[model samples]
Target chain A: MVTMQNYDNIEYLSETIRVCIKRRFGDDCEIANIALATLGGSNRTVLFNVVRGSYPLRLVLRQETVPSEYSPFLPSDMQYRVLEVVYEHGIPVPRPLFELEAADNLGQGYVVTAVPGETLPKRLINSAEYVTMRARFLQQSAEILAKLHTIDHVLVPGLSALQESSDPLGAQIALYDRYGEPHPAIEFAFRYLAKYEPEHGAKNFLHGDFRNGNMIVGTEGIRVLLDWECAHTGSVMEEIGWFCARSWRFGRVDLAAGGFGDRETFYRAYEKASGNLVDRESSRWWEIFGVMRWAIYNIMQSHGHLSRERRSPAFAACGRNTGIIEYDLLKIIAKEFD
Target chain B: MIWSARMFNDPPNASELLLTVREYIEQLLPDLERQDKYHGLCCTYLLDVVMRELEEPPNIGDHSNNALKALLNNKDELSETEFMSSLCASIRRGDQDGNLDRLLILLTSHVSKKVRVSNPDYLDTKDYL
Candidate 1:
């Protein structure tokens, strides 16, 4: 509901947001410290301090950005609904407050209580403050993902069975084709995957972008899992593979589990949590698929910059990262073959 | 002065110039904040890649074609790009199902060549294979 005129001014938007909060929490609520949150690339997140009566609250307002070709087709409302369901199910997600009303004159999105922690992967891995948690990071992450996968898909509104469940390799090829440019390396990976398609497993909730950078970590452990926009119904192994993907390791290829621990430690923790045996072969296949997916996404990000859909030096650098991902993909596949 | 057409050998080659710029940016990176720092780091990395490309351009085409030729066991008039595209198509069509090993070898060789140019460090650290 953001009008064209007031949309560009943060101060005006803050006052308007104050009015909306006043409507919800009565006129006793006061909003202040309206500042932008740093990490979200696809959405605009605003952090604000809310004083309601005698209590103070830290909250986040996530507003959907203008959709581009790269934006996931899933609605922002769907994400909010998913967050609500996940939080209800004891998941470590920010507590969902409420979705914005059209009458509020703010753009589409919702409000949630902000989790107190950091999401920066470099800091999480290297900072002295997080040293105590690093040893248990892999097991903690695995446990969270295992719990997430156990959530009944029927419980989440707007959640649908993944099309990839039927033909995992073909779906990726089709997606790449949709991008309208032929990448010989990616095409080669696709063919390789198709030729050696892994045995299908039971479908579950796949946290499509599960990685260290998306998790908010504190001294205790993982505070909350963030970025649920890519959530979908697929193989549980898909989430595992994605979490262990080389790119997610953040340059520490030595530590397989998001640069925190070895693959066995992560797999063992997940198996223990979910009561499901880990299929090493199938998991490895999905790992390769994860790398390829990341490579394709890097290209898409670069294309966004190159095509002027979004002009960012980071996107251009992401395009170059496709090479490193391809290198890892080849290395992993070759090692598997041997 | 002899009137002869010739290409000049420049003192500051493309790689050298890119390295200089990358170094300068790397020095200034400490001053940047938040988004600017992130973008500055990316720019520095991009320059590094461009420098690497100039110094050691990948010949993946030749490596891929050679591998493909061996796998197909036939010498044809198809260009390298055409052959690669056709190979991908054939694999997609399940024509290579019977020869998965050969396909793996070809792909590994091609991708390895690319890695050599894109990031030789990957090859150096990856001793698993």
Candidate 2:
């Protein structure tokens, strides 16, 4: 229920944030330019610059918003822990600074060093500066995911406590049914998936929301794989297939690997990095499942707007916008039958 | 008898009215701030959808009902909502596993018709139809 007005009082936030930073970096720290981030829709992101003696630091503060219907079980502190583990293991993740104390009055949230790069899909795919980077996009994504999947759940604290589902298709069906809304396209897709469920592979760490928009692209390649809120212990193919999902392509349907490269190139890179064979059939199955999941998510987002929990034009448009996804789902599923 | 019925009571239909409002908002967009401009663009897009709906109403209800009846192989006179719910339940129970070929055809046609109303450009770009 945090309105836009709650963030307007910069003075109150600056005072509270200053105390949190002082506790972390000593009493000589000063916080400035704390304002809302423009990009994310689910959480409240505040970017600020901190000065401690002669050193200047750029950091981001992420706060939890009112829980939407699709919000994952991983809280901000749990995500901070996951980031800590990922960063320590040489993954390109923003360094976790610290979690806010109860006295900070910022509700539930944490801070991380702000990595400088572009996360917008349009710029990453079409911009002149990223032309060369686009060539290595798929390979780099594969390498990162391969490395991420190798992380030990026991070593990474609190990761095992996060939900794990062996039957992802069943879980998705239960979720759709719980929504109490009938989507014929989604039901049809789910039925298709159920009848052709792929063989389950070994469970591994999954970057739940690994896609074009979730990544921060730099001149070299992916600077950081962001948004670990959906991270879970699942099949490696699920992560690979989620990346190749058409919805994540963002209108550049020609390039299947997040609009960067073909599916073969992506699969090859992943195999090279993980030392495991990639099954095309399994990946395709997950891709179809990913599309259906996204369509359901769109419906949930529109409901959020309709129920007045969150009011934004973007959310309101999702209900009708599902048509395009439905079309894509039918096309992919039909090809399998053929 | 012909003169008794009034013709052209309103010159502009619902579609025309929506177009006029959308045009006015587009004109005022340049003066608005960044956030307001984005919201104005969304409003314009919504109005465009409304105009499309008015010009050619989508036949989703009829199409869905027909698809459901074909899947169940029954001609029960059920409401669109009820029929879809029953079909979904049947699908969840794996009733369509043996007849996937038929279900696939029905689903494809159903979604294609939906895209025609919501975003026909999808079909044109993919060359699906």
Best by TM-score: 2
| Candidate 1 per-residue lDDT over residues B52-122, each given as its tens digit | 66655344357555767676665677876676667766766677768766766666666666566556676
In the order shown, the chain A TM-scores of the predictions are: 0.90, 0.91
Taking all chains together, the TM-score of candidate 1 against the true structure is: 0.83
Q: Residue A142 deviation, candidate 2, in Å?
A: 1.5
- For each candidate in the order shown, give its overall lDDT on alpha carbons: 0.74, 0.77
In the range A220-288, model 2's lDDT, one tens digit per residue, is: 888898888777777888888999998987778888888888899999999999999898988889999
Worst 10 residues of 2 chain A by lDDT: A1-10
Clashes in model 2: which pairs? none
Interface C-alpha RMSD, model 2: 1.8
- Every candidate's DockQ is 0.39, 0.56
Q: For residues A1-338, write the lDDT of model 1, one tens digit per residue.
A: 35524544778878978988998988888998887665354556788888977788999988776363446434578788889888888889999999998888887888999888788897887788875687777778888888888888777655664445455666566666666654556766786777677766677876678898998888888889888877778788778888888887776777778878888888999899889988877777888899998887777777767766556788787776776777677667768521
TM, every model: 0.83, 0.87
